[model samples]
Target: MFAASIKSKTQSLRLQSSRLMPLSQQYRAQSNLSNNKSYWSHIPSWKGVSNDEFVSYRWQLRNTVSDKLKLYKFLDEVLPERLGSTENEQLKRIRTRTNFIEDAIAAIKLAPMAIRLTPHVLSLIDWNNPLDDPIRRQFLPLRSSIIPDHKYLELDSLHEEQDSPVPGLVHRYPGRALFLATSICPVYCRFCTRSYAVGGNTDTVSKKPQKPSRKRWEVVFEHIANDKSLQDIVVSGGDSYFLQPDHVREIGERLLDIPHIKRVRFASKGLAVAPGRILDDSDPWTDNLIAVSNKGREMGKQVCLHTHINHANEITWITRLAANKLFKHGVIVRNQSVLLKGVNNTFTALSDLIKSLSDINIQPYYVYQCDMVQGIEDLRTPLHEIIDLDKQIRGTLSGFMMPSFVIDLPGGGGKRLVSTYEKYEHGIATYKAPGLPGAKGEMTYTYHDPKPVKTAVLEEFQQRQLEALERGETLEQFFAQSAAHLPRSPLPNPSSNQNPLRPQTTSTDIVPEFWAPTPKPAYAYSQGM
Candidate 1:
């Protein structure tokens, strides 16, 4: 019976592949286009172009010519100037791969693939053109934060088991534990903070750690049961939803048995990276989500599916259908996005993304600044750009749709809010600022005013605020600090024991509080002060 089912699924997948453009054919099309020299004159210079400007240019030109043809022309114009002197053949290879993907996407028939192609289009962007500077292009944070990857299990480090659970099971938080379940993903992101574990193609994980055997799942449960302080288990892997339905149901049952484990959350990118996995009702993973939700409810635990979607364009019909199914099964839905340099870095892009997510009943969660994995240096956007983009997004978006922008400190300290730094310039740090762009610059708003201006006071004040944040201040503390609201001078430096950028336990984790559901608002709450 099992063999029959497996064979049935394989056949179904093969059928689906037939309707799709074969990756090989797509590659050949792009290669043929690139070899044609006729389109070279239309190619534009890569110089003096900001990522946003480049995107605008692509959209403006998209109708005039095919994306593949445009890319062929683009490469022709820039290759001579950029690749002529560089020995890093890797960059050239990536460009070629990108060209193929772009051409394929331009002709894709599936709605989900169309949405998926949007990020690929954005990825080809160049945000660091020196000529683009001073133009102040918006960007997502793709750098290492206070929380570092070193704190977690490195990819190549494990061998005894297929998967293993870390001892610090319950991180700094009382009710949350990070569950490393799988080491697989359909697409490898360049700026993944957990790059050491995800995207096996990169050599970064070649010498890291491996997961222990399934027996280790019990070890994870034992840790959760022993730690009365913890009540929720965040089931994460390269992507938790990647697990089979039976595995998910079994994990759910185990968590449900633990009276203390009140929630089971699946952190999965499958909904975004490989929505097809979830689109087919016959897919076991799709069944797993329903089964897990049922088990959680039966055990009285809140079951939620947290999806990672970085752009508005990623909301495809397949993902939308999958999200709806999860919700119908009594599973709450939420989304987390990582801010990256060339992808969804602008206010317009973020605003569009949030609106789309909200429309599908997925509450916007954290918009994490990118982590500090090696090779992701290309994805880091300036901190100031994130702040500026947040400012633009705050008013237009509903409060629920606005995610807390954060930087996960390196060395496993945990996530620290990045958007709170806006308070440094004003004389005082307050939750609601007085000088937002449209609110008459006097009315109160969610953001705070920077420390008051004083040539003498400015630098010192910024230093203090920066120091405090590095110390792992919560979103509330970072923005709420004022001369009157703070403790005595020489205020406790949260990061005093280590570099602020590296991870340290933040105030939120130490408190003996259970993970509580955010209270639903009575009405459409505006970001009114």
Candidate 2:
């Protein structure tokens, strides 16, 4: 009887694989477009560029877009006269080249993050349908889709500034610390949680940029050495990728030398956005990283690279080769992805991304809820969406491959599982961080979903706001005249430490129901949950 049962199950497994084999092959083929194609040549300026030139890390840096004029020129060259239409009602107004450019420039003026894009990332955007493309949505701000910030959205949402013991070192958790080594990235994300300090100053924000300097770093290093309880250190900045090869080695070695430090993670999104650097033999960035990993292993401490790659589309042949190089070299690499509204918020997108990552041997570490930061209300999904998506994706992957879906609680309460909420109702979800030290452990933190606006009303509001922006009205002036009648949002928990960072509302409808019904399970290959 046992043999018969086993035989039947084995036959069933064969049947399932046979059916999925073709689709899986198709998926791999579509994903490896860079296998033969020079993907960046699609852009006008790089039409005649060779693969060697394109793969040079220096070439990517020299061609990176930083200022408004370069960005505008790129947009003019890439966006078609008439863009492909979209299912997104909020982004419908951005169909024409003129509509898209004007709306984007205006959005840039209001954004907290400045524009910065590498040629590799630029090449990945589907210009034919820029507005709805996930890569474009993550890096570029669109005024048409911009909405009023939830009353709780803040510039420094996690209260990093409050917990920062040293100027750039954030000591929040008992044994862990975030060493912000710089304030620049190869590409500035529109939804950056560290907008308070990263990137150049935008029109709406004056930044406290943390430039790389050994003088400044010594204080941070000394503090870490003295703190006997510290065991983990996350060295992040504009990005460790922006650091010189020497900086990477120095920082990694310095931290590893500390007696209490058991782990050192150098965080950067370079492997995803500018992957060629890992393959550039002339560059020593990858060499330094590998050296540190080997040294840490010999010392019985762990040193690894924590990269951010949110979408599977961000992974190319270069990304795969880069990941493989690290894996073969004994460099441990892990990924942390953000759950953006139009990006990887669905179970299918999220699960596919996880599978794609694990296939390259990069552990899918954490799927973070979007932070409560300024200028990115458009990218945030309601809290329940993350909770539901987590349920749908958990059992689909191997136990070790599954990621922790969490929200880094809005004050300094730290990361907790999405389902660990103390109370969730009326578009508001509250949690307590008992893991945090002091009274903060007993205090409650809160997260409010972006307020709703009916589609027609929101589209109208965008049109009016865009008109005001063109006529020289600042983002502040436009909101000042329109907020009086909108509904009030829930205040933060009194015991929590977040100060409300609400912008005056242009308009909003209440999100009355916070609890959603348990969703039906998704098919393995479905496009959405």
The sequence of per-residue lDDT tens digits that candidate 2 reaches over residues 60-113 is 999998888888898999889999999888788677998998888878877878
Which stretches of model 2 miss by more than 4 angstroms?
A: 1-35, 455-529
lDDT, candidates in the order shown:
0.47, 0.81
Candidate that would win on TM-score = 2
**How far off is model 2, as Cα RMSD?**
12.5
Winner by lDDT:
2
Question: What would you estimate as the lDDT of candidate 2?
Answer: 0.81
Worst 10 residues of 2 by lDDT: 520-529
Compose the digit string of candidate 1's lDDT tens values, residues 1-529.
Answer: 9999999999999767653643223222323222222211223443443323322313322322223354344334433332222222222332243343332232121101101122322333332231122111121111111111111212221111212234314254335767766655444444544544453321112213234347767777787788786777787765675566678777777777877778888888767644534434234665666667777777667888898888765555545655665555566888888776545788777788888888888888988765544323334555566667777788787676788886554333345576544343321122322322233233321221111122233234334434554675521233234323423223247867743322223233311111111221211111100
| TM-scores for all predictions | 0.52, 0.84
Assess candidate 2 and give its TM-score to the true structure. 0.84
